[model samples]
Structure formats: structure tokens, C-alpha cells
Target: MLGLMQDWPLRLHRLIDHAARHHGARPIVSRSVEGPVHRTDYAAIHRRSLALAQRLAREGVKPGDRVATMAWNTWRHIEAWYGITGAGAIYHTLNPRLFPDQIAWILNHAESRLMFCDLSFLKLLEGLAPKLPHILRFIVLTGPETMPETSLPGAVDYESWLAEADGDFEWVAGEENAAAGLCYTSGTTGEPKGVLYSHRSNVIHALACNAPDMLGLSATDRVMPVVPMFHANGWCLPFIAPLSGASLVLPGPKLDGESLQSLMQAEGVTFTAAVPTVWLGLLQYLEASSAPLSTLKRVVIGGSACPRALTAAFERRGVHVVHAWGMTETSPIGTICGVKPEVAGRDAEGTLDLQETQGFPPFTVDMRIVGDDGAEKPWDGTTFGNLQVRGPTVTRGYFKAERDALTPDGWFETGDVATIDPAGYMHITDRTKDVIKSGGEWISSIELENLAMGHPDVAEAAVVAARHPKWDERPLLVVVPKAGREVSRDSLLAHLAPQVAKWWLPDDVVVVAEIPHTATGKILKTKLREQFAGYFGVP
Candidate 1:
């Protein structure tokens, strides 16, 4: 028999409601694309969101309709998320960094009726207008003064549209399992697939990610998410900030190192999250200028592995670095590396080593690794296998796929190969397809790349499997040297000699001016493999 208790459903709108009711004056700051920083409070955000919902309803935006947005992280985009969801519609974020054809295809695939875009993408949208016939309207996210003349149909300024409503309407209520948001993968493996998120899943993910051992956020902190809103819902920071009553800062379209450092310092931001590449730029700028990040207390790095040198650099400056791991399919927050009680006694060096791992999951998510025979591997820190995960927030299937993307036993196969230590820290070795094979043994390219990044002269590093005749396959190191620094092959190899097994060493080193990357700032190894496929004279 089920226990008797309150049956109130947990919905996404309640997060905004909680912030508006209790933390009304908490600031929601943003750098506007029009050339200045703008500030608004939760109370104003709540009121404007209600106005937006009313406007949507009046325009015949029915429940379950897909509303598209192609804007940066700003106050307007944040309001659109809640407003669209409150009107019982799904918000689909279109990544501007994606190819124009892909963006058009995604818009048509999702059947988005109305779109809200920034002024910078106006020309882009105009160029793709011929390909996107299903889009009925284009609402520019700006005021009358900054709005530009556009050729798209049914175009209007956001301020004019939002001013039509007085926020007199209440949020439309529905089941917790209704679709709320849509995010597509980077399509590295194949065609981009959409991961539909439900209201219950989004709310649950925010709750789990806000725990003490997870992000550990509090109301008194100022938070910034350098990650884009169009990417995995800005890594869920939009929701986490409001749910915890933290002041949110959006960097707008200016993500350069100097701009970011200036914003963080001016706002007194204490917590922030972004990929490793962003931090590398900031560190470079700080080294050149000798600037201090006096207000930053912690930074959570993801999107790619955090180099050990990068982590140590931040720690040396008295800022904590957290290595998190997740994908669009996992609501983008499967694990966060917060220190646990059992490993608290370690010294500084040991702690940094442990922090390099992806860390364990919260109770909401489950993780495991299995070998070729479908047997669970031991948590010995050295035995690596195919990583698998399953949880309430994890996607059971793609948005419109014919079949579920799960194994016969119902676990989602993450493309990564990893090992779980005895203390439950999970460390990723390599992707299943990217792992190199020498003779019959497996070698992790990620391991070699991470070691290469520690070199003082190396600015960036990548490893790919180059075909070898004698060994079947071997690892090749590709590096981009720092400006005006001479990084020779012998010196890098000598630096890595003592720390790793001799067999795991790269067969050769190749220097390049730059490496190609995906739209999400990840190394595009497919291109690297093709470029150096015959480096060893293998047929």
C-alpha cells in the first residue's frame, strides 16, 4: 500500500515562483548584445515571464507547441524559458554555432512555430528563411531603438510584444511528465538526435545538482555560467540559480578572456562553470597581465577533460576546480567531483590527482562499467571497460526515434570507457571508438594527451590512433606550441618518461599550427585521424 501524503506535482514553474516569492530582490545580471550591461531582479523576471506567457497564449501558442530560441545567455532568454514552459509549450534552443543547413533542418524537424532570436543572428535567420517555411513569426529580442529592419515574415520587437500583456494571467498547469525542453546532440557519431526533457526530470535534476556534495550552491553566492544557453540548457545553471536564490550573471556574446575577467571582478562572482578551453584563455590573460581573480572561489570545468596543469594552476591561485562529466543525454550533470569524507585525509598533490577524475554520482544517477563478456569490472582504478549509466533523469530514447537507445537490459551505453576506483571516483580513459590498440592490448589516447598538456611549452594537445604496420595501431601525439616557444619531440617525451608505462608512450610527435574542433569546443579527432592516417607508412 502506498503511504498517504501530499500529492502536489513538482513542476518547473514552481522554481521561478519560489524565487519571486522569497528572493524577489535577487539580481539577474546580463551583458546586453546592444553594448551595455543590464540588471533585473527575480520579481521583475517573474512578472515579465508571466507577460510573455500571456502574449504566447493570445497568439494561439497551444500546449505542446514548440517555441524556438536562438539567443545567447541573457535576461531575455531566461524569461523565455519559463514563459514558454508556463504556457505549456516546449522551448527548443537552436545553437548558433551549428551549420546553417543543420539549423534549418532542426527548426523544420521540431516544427517550431515562432522564434526569438538576438540581433546578431538576424542576417543568419534571413539567409535561412527560404529553408524554414514552417516558422510563422520572428520576434527579435530587443527594444524598438535597437531593432533592425528585417525581411522575415511576421517580425516584431520583443518589448512591443511583451508590453501587450499586463501579467494578469496564471501559469497553465499540467502533468509533471509533460515535455518541457528539447536539446540536440552535436552529431559527432551520426545525425543529430534530440533529447526531450520532461518537467519532472528537469525539476529533479535541479534538485539533485544543488545538493551539498554536488554544486553545493547557496543563496548568498553570485554565480556565472559561461556556457551558452543553447547548449544543454546552459548546463542547467538557469534553473539551479533560481532554485537556490543565487544571483545569476550572463556574459552575453562577449566570451573573450579580458571581458570575462572584467565581468567576474566587477560583479564579485564567487562561483562559475565552463569548459577547460575558457579557463585556458583566462589563465593566459592573467599570466600576461598578472591579474588576480580575487572574487572567484570555485570553478566547475566540463565539456572536455580538465588538464591536470590547468587544475593545479587554478588551485595555486586559491580557486577550487571541480571536474564534472555528463552529456546531453544525461541532463548534462551525471557526476561532479566534490571531496568525500573517506578521501579527506590526502595531501595537496594527492587531492589534485583525485580531483582529475570525474567523481561519483548523486543518488539520482547510477553508474557502472562492463568488459567484453558483459561482466562487471572491478573498481581497481586500472581495469577499464565500457561505461554504462541509468537513472530517472537519463534519456530512455531519442525524441522521435523508432526504438529506445538502451541495451536489452535497459542501461544506456555512454560512448566512454572508464574505471571506477575503490573510493568510487570514476575516471574516463577514452571513447570506445577513439581508444588505440597496440598488438592486442588497449591504450588510452586521453592519458597521453593529458600528460602532454603538462608540458610548459605546449598550448594544446590531442592524440589519435595512427595506423601502424608492426603493432596494428599506435598512438600519435599532435600538439600546438605556445607562442614563440620551441617544443621539440625529445623534450616532451623525456618529460613524460618517468610517470607512465613505457609501452603507453606515443610512437611519434607531430606539431601543428592548430587543431580542428567541434562547435562545442571538443577536439575533432576524426579529422586528426584522417590527416595522419598514413604517418607511419602503413598501407
Candidate 2:
């Protein structure tokens, strides 16, 4: 009963092809590490990517070989991304912020044969370059003038390497299920494991994110993705932006407040996406400068819960903060903060409250919360349980893992505890490991942090479990106050008393200058627990 339709497979290279054909003039702006802003177009990127593919082929890069990139978010990185995949090789984005040993370990584990890195990260990789015996060549993403001398086995300037070939080649089309990209997690829970994304999954994720009700991107928008390409495929931005024909503004190495604001002004960026900490930094810069993001409309914040104060700050400037939720395993976008049709009629205050939740699952995703006994939980928004999902873009297992990570009935257990509302909105309670147990009860660390962030003086906050004599474990409030702002423990506790159950209040408050963060900008609660595990005198 097969239908007589064309069986053409969807590949990511065709996305760039489409952009070049239709939106060739759309600009791709990058503040390259070479110290200047380089502006190119979709047509230019496509032609250059073709040259890159040809050059890779000439360099003996074979299909299914691993090609690594240790660079920032820039046009050259995008070019490498497509060229590597276009040549039917997997694109492994190496995070430079990770520990150097971890980077070396990941590169060895993936057996990466070649690498494309920015000049800035060359020194960081120098110490481990000799150890990566599998790597055949290293193409520095810079011109010959700026390329530094390195001890990498086989190194060349990218411009010279690309010049070896012209944009006179066709992309090698592989099966849709062929691995196209690889990203490892932040290893907050354990060692970083690789998640291989097929061409099909990446193509599908781009389609889903650009849907009208999702990110709702179009050709007219000027998009800027501040999230690094090394992290979760840059949340699939490198694909989605080109597919939508939107002009791009890639914020390379300088993600500081002044640098970002300057780029936004120069480029007239209309839409952007990043984690909460990034937005917090931008907002602080704006507040300090008394500036306005005139052309910016909406910002998608994820990687951590969007603080209520941060959301309100953006709203005050007539911008919308879309609270998103995802992990590296979900192809990074499971849910976004857009209202469903049923809940669209709520009042302003009610709408604000609704947006604070993680919103509903998008079209391709299926979600459910399961109780301790493995039964489906009620959708009352009050009963929290283990969140599980199954989707086309979801990974069935790690890259080389032995076992399939799925329930017997076929759902992947997301390590989050979430509650779904009757209206179908999902609210994340906390990570399984971060939830506190007190005298046979559970408390959500996310909820406590959200409430604590509402206080005026508290710039940042994290709640972790500490041993207690009677309850086995109790909550500890770790606060980082605003610069030069006085914060008393009594006031912060008073603010939380009315919002949550009295028993759920933190045992004590400790002030610190700064909080440790993961490469993705999430609070490293594991570190916090390790540092303060015995606060209540446990072994």
C-alpha cells in the first residue's frame, strides 16, 4: 500500500541552497575574532560552504568521518558546520569553555579526524594538540596574516585552504538518518555523553522551531542567536535562521553588555535568543546606561528558569520574554512560552502568570508526567511528577551507549519534574536531584529560587538540600545580592513566608559574592551541594 509519491530525503544542505536561491541578499553579520565585523550574505555563505566541502574532499575527509569545530558563533563557524555536513561528515562542536582535558577527551572519544578552530582558541588547544593523534589537519578560521604558528600536526589558514577549491561542487547527499551533528551535555550529572543528531532530526527541528506558533520567524526578521553553536547545536539556530531566510547577526567572542548592545544598534536586530543570565546582563547594561532596545521585539530565554523580575524588566520596555525549556537531549527545544488558544483570553496579569510557566509542548512533541508507581499523573498543575516525552527529534539513546534509554512503553524520561495544567501548559518544578526531601515531603528548588529572585535586593539565588537532624534534608538558600545593595537575611525570609508553606522555608541564608555556573549558564547546584553538604553536621 505504498503511495506513488517522490521519496526524496530531506537534508540540511538543501536549506542553505534554498536560502541562496531565494534570499541570497540576506546578510550574515559576524564580529569575527580577527578584530573586525565581517558582513556577508546567504549567497556568499552557500558559495563558500561549497568551496569548503570541495576542500574537505580534497583533504581526504571521507563520509562518516568526524569533523570538529572549536570556535565561537560566527559566519566561519556556520560555513564549517554546513561544509562538514554537506560533505556527509558529522559536525562535532567542541566547547572551548569546557576544561581542556574534557575537550581533549571528547575529541578523542569522537575520534575527530580534522578540526576548524578560531584563532582565539588555538592556544587553549595547543597543550593537547599533540595528544589528539587521530586529528589529521587543523584549519584555523582566519586569514594567513593572522594565523599563528602552532604545533598541530597538519595546520593551515582557512582562507588558503578554502582557496584551494572553488564553489563548483555539489553536496554529497547521504541518507536522511545519517548522523549530521554531535553535541555533548554539560556533565552536570555525570561525564559528558555525546548525542548524535541525524540529518532528519535536525531538519525536522528547524521546521518545528520556525512554525508560526513556535519561534514564528520569517524572512523579514533580523535574527541574532547569542547562544554558542557548541551548545546544543546552538539550539538549532544555525539551521533555523537560514531556513527562514532571515538576516543574521552572529555575536562572536564579545558577549559583554556593551559589545552586545553596540551590535544590536548597528544591525537593528529584531529578534534574539539566549539564556536568562545573558538577558540579565543585557538588562543590567541597559538599566545602567538608561538605554532602549529600540528594534528588538521578543527574546527567548532558556537554559535556566526565566526569573520573574527579569521578565518584568523586559516587559517594562515593551519586549516579551519567552520562557523556554529544553535540554541537550531534546534537540534542545521541547517547549516555549506561547499561549495556547484556550488560555489566550486571560487578563494581563493572568497572562503574565501563564507565560511564567514553561507553556505547552509544540506540535511534534508528546509529554506526560508519571507518578512514583508508574501511572500517569493528573493534569491539575499541582501534582508534580517525572516528565517523560517521545518525539521525532528526541534521541533514543546516547551516541555509543549500549542500552536504549526508553521506558518499556517507549517514552524517554526527561530528568525534570513537571506539572501539566488542565489547559495543557507544563510547569517545571525542579530537577530530580535538586528536589529537597523534608520529613517525608518534597519541595521544588526551582519554585523557591523563582520566589527568592522576586525580592528587590537578591540579584541571584539557588536552593540546595542540606542535611537536617529530623527531616533527613532541608533547603538552604544561597543568595548573591545586587552590587552595593544591602540584603538582610530576615527580609529575604520574610518575603518567602507568605508565598510558600512555612515549613518549606530555607533553614538559613548565606551570602556570597558570586555563584558558580555551567558552560551553558545554569547554576551548578552539584558544586553548591558539595561545598555545603554537611552544613547540618552529616557525614
Candidate 3:
């Protein structure tokens, strides 16, 4: 006999409706570009979203049509997101940090019909407007008082456009499998490929993320997602927070340590998520300032591994740091290194060590490590292999690209070399492309990078494989030293000597002013590879 559970169709609009009905008064706060904090509630957001939906429909946005948004994390951006999706249109978030050519290419590739952006990006939009053939209209997310007169005509103020719209509208109903949003991967190699998220996938991902074991979001929690809305929907916190009726604090265009710290204190934020660079700034700011994060309870660090020092600092301050691992393909949450019940009583050092791992898979995710011969490896934490995952949230295939990336059995190759312990904990050793092979032995650049970051003088580090005639390839360490701190190559190399295998140590160390990074805050090793391609051995 079938179970008596309700057969509910998961959809994005349903989540918004639930929040509006049950948690209408919950606050969704944002720090705007004008240096003022703007506060709204779920009811207002829902009403504005409906108005936005009506405006989008009037702008010729048909079902499944792509509506591109190039804006920061703000209440209006969130409204635009739900509004576009609620009207049966696809919401495509354009990363502003990408090159103009890449942005133009994505806009054309996605066939976006309507473009909504913040007033801050007027110059950027004007520069690339000539190349975006698919974008028929431009709507600035600002009032008429601040709308600038630019060479690119036909721009409409967001408030004025929505004023002519009506909020008394019904959400367009469609199949749960209908495409809801599209996000392009950071194109390190070829042109960026798109990951189309279905309404069902998004809703499920949001629900899974809200569970007590995962992010454990609630209406009582105040969240500040320092991760930009352009990056994997700020790791899906925007949707999950509103759905859970949590108070959201969005830092728009101002991610500096002072600004973020002030907002966190002012809003009494309990949870926040961002990449390592942003946290580094906050940690440094906290170290110098006497301000206490009185309400902060959890910090989610992803996009890169969190430094051990940073994790320890937060833990000492009574804030839990959950190191997460995922990509643009996995709805950006594969593993969250939360404290398991079994290890809850472990000593501070031991617990911190476990927290440093990539963590175990969440409820909806399944992970496995495959050897070169395609055989699954034992979970001993010593046998490193290529990581593969299959889940409800993982992308099945790239939009309009070859399906070869997906396995016959439906797993997506994560391209990360990792180890899974018997306890089901996964630790990423390195990316397949980033793994350095010397004399037929694999060297994990991630391990080296982590070790380098542990040095007090080193602020940032990236390890890239350099060509070597003797042993196929070798590693070159690029480091960004702490401000006003001096570090020599020998001293930094010595710091790692006792921490790693002898051969795994970097072959050469190069100090640089700064390490290049992708738009999503990941170190751009692809560019580093090109910069030092000719240096086969010690230069």
C-alpha cells in the first residue's frame, strides 16, 4: 500500500505564497547603494513581486522567457527574481564581475528579453548595450529621482514601471519541472555554460537547506548573506530565508568589513554566509574593533576553504563556522561541515579539525569517490579519487551544451579529487585539473594551499602546476602576504615542511602582491597556469 503522505507539487511560487501567508510580517532588510538601510516585510515583498510579475508580463515576458538581472543582493533584486519566475519567466542572474564580452555573450546565449539592473551599473550596461541584441528593454532598479540620463535611451525607472502595474494577479501555474532560473558557470576554460534550474529542484533545494541539520533556518534567525545574489542565488539563502520567514540582511555593493560588521550588529544577525575573502576582512575588523557580534551564531564559509585560524577565531567567539563545498552545478550546497551529534563533545581542537573538512553530504546529496579505472574507492580517508555526486539539486546538464558531462547512471563529475572517511566525511584534496602529477605521483595543490594559508604572514595563497621536463609537472606556490608583513620564500616553505609530505611540498615559492581570482572569489589558477607556464623549473 502507498504511504499516506500528501502528493504536493514543489514550486517556487508556492514557497513565496507560504511566507506571505504565514510570515507576512517578517523583515527582509537591505543596505542600499545610497548608504541607508531599507526594511520591508514578506507581505510587501510578495505584493511587490506580484506587481513586478504584472510589469514583466506587460513587457512581453512570456512563459519560459529569460529575464536577466544584473544587480546586487537587495530587496528589489529579490522581488525581481520571484516576480520573473512567478510570471512563468526564467530569471537569469548576470555576474557583473565578468568581462564585458562574457556578459554580452551570456545575455545573447540565454536569449534574455528584458534586462533589470541597478543604477550603479548604468555605465556598464551602456557600454555593452550595443552588443546585447536579445535584451529589448532596460529597467533600472531605482526611483525617478536618481535615474541618470545616459546615452543608452529607453531606460525606465523601476518604481515608475511598477507603478503602472497591478499586484492583484495570480501566479502562472506550470509543471513543476518548468525551468525557473539560469546561472552560468565561471568560464575558466571555454565560454561559460548555463545551468538551468527547474522550479521543483529549486524548491526542494531550499527546503533541504532549511532543515535543522543543514542551515537550520527559522523566523527567529537574522541572516546576512554577504554572498552576492549573482553567485548561485547567494547559495540559495535568499529563497530559503524568505521561505523560512527568517530576517534577511542584504549588504548591497558594500561588502567591506566595517560596513558588514556594523550591519550585523545593528540587525542582530544570527547567521551569515560568504566566501573566505569576505570573512577574512570581517575577522580582521573584529580583531581591531571592540564591537561584539552579540547575536551572531553561525557563519557559513564556502567558494573556498576556510582558514583554520579564521574558523578558530569564530568558534572562540561562540560562533559556529560551517565549511561548505559545492559548485555552480549543485545549487551551490553539497556538503556542510556542521557538528554531528556523535562528535559534539569532542575537544575544541578535535572539533575544529572536523569542521575544517568539506563535511558530509546533506540529506538530498549522494557522494562517491571514483578511481582512474572508474571503480569506487573505499571510505578510508586515505584513498583520494575523483568526486562524483547525484542529487535532486545537482544540475543534470548544461543548457544547450553536450550531455557527456553526465554519467549514464546520472551522476555529475565534480572534477574534485577527494577522500571520504568511514564516518562519511568528505575532504577535497584538489581539483582534477589542479592536481599536480610529478614522477607519476599526485600532489594535492589544495593541501599545499591550505598549509600556506596557515602561516601567519601569508594572507592568501594559490598553488598551480608548472610544466616540468623531468617529471611532467611540478607545483609553483603564489602567495599574497599580509599587509605590512614581510615573508621570504624560504621561511614560508619551512612553515609547511613539517605539515605535509616531503615531495608534496611546492617546488618553488613566488611572492606576489595579490592572487588573481574568478568572479565568484575562487582563485584563478587557470590564469596562473598561463602566467608561469614557461617556468618549468627554478627560474
Question: Each model's TM-score?
Answer: 0.99, 0.98, 0.97
In candidate 1, list every pair of residues with a backbone clash.
Answer: none
Model 2 TM-score is: 0.98
Worst 10 residues of 1 by lDDT: 184-193
Candidate 1 lDDT over 323-416, as tens digits, reads 9999999988989998989889899999988988999997789999999777899999999999999999999999889999998888899999
- lDDT score at residue 525, model 3, on the 0-100 scale: 88
Sorted by TM-score (best first), the order is 1, 2, 3
Residue 38 in model 3: lDDT: 95
C-alpha lDDT score of every prediction, in listed order: 0.92, 0.89, 0.88
lDDT of 2 by residue, 1-539 (tens): 99999987888898999999999999999999987999999999999999999989988888899999999999999999999999999999988888888888889989999999998887887888878989989999999999888987788999988998977899997899999999998776667899999999999999987787789889999999999998888988889988999999999999988889899988999889998888878877997898668998889888888878888888888888888888888898999888678888888668778877988767778899998778999999899999999998888999789998899998989889999999888999899888998999999898899889999898899999999888999999999998789788899999999989999999999999999998778899999999889998885
Q: Any idea what lDDT model 1 has?
A: 0.92
Residue pairs in collision within model 2: none
lDDT of 3 by residue, 347-386 (tens): 8889877987888877788999998888899999889999
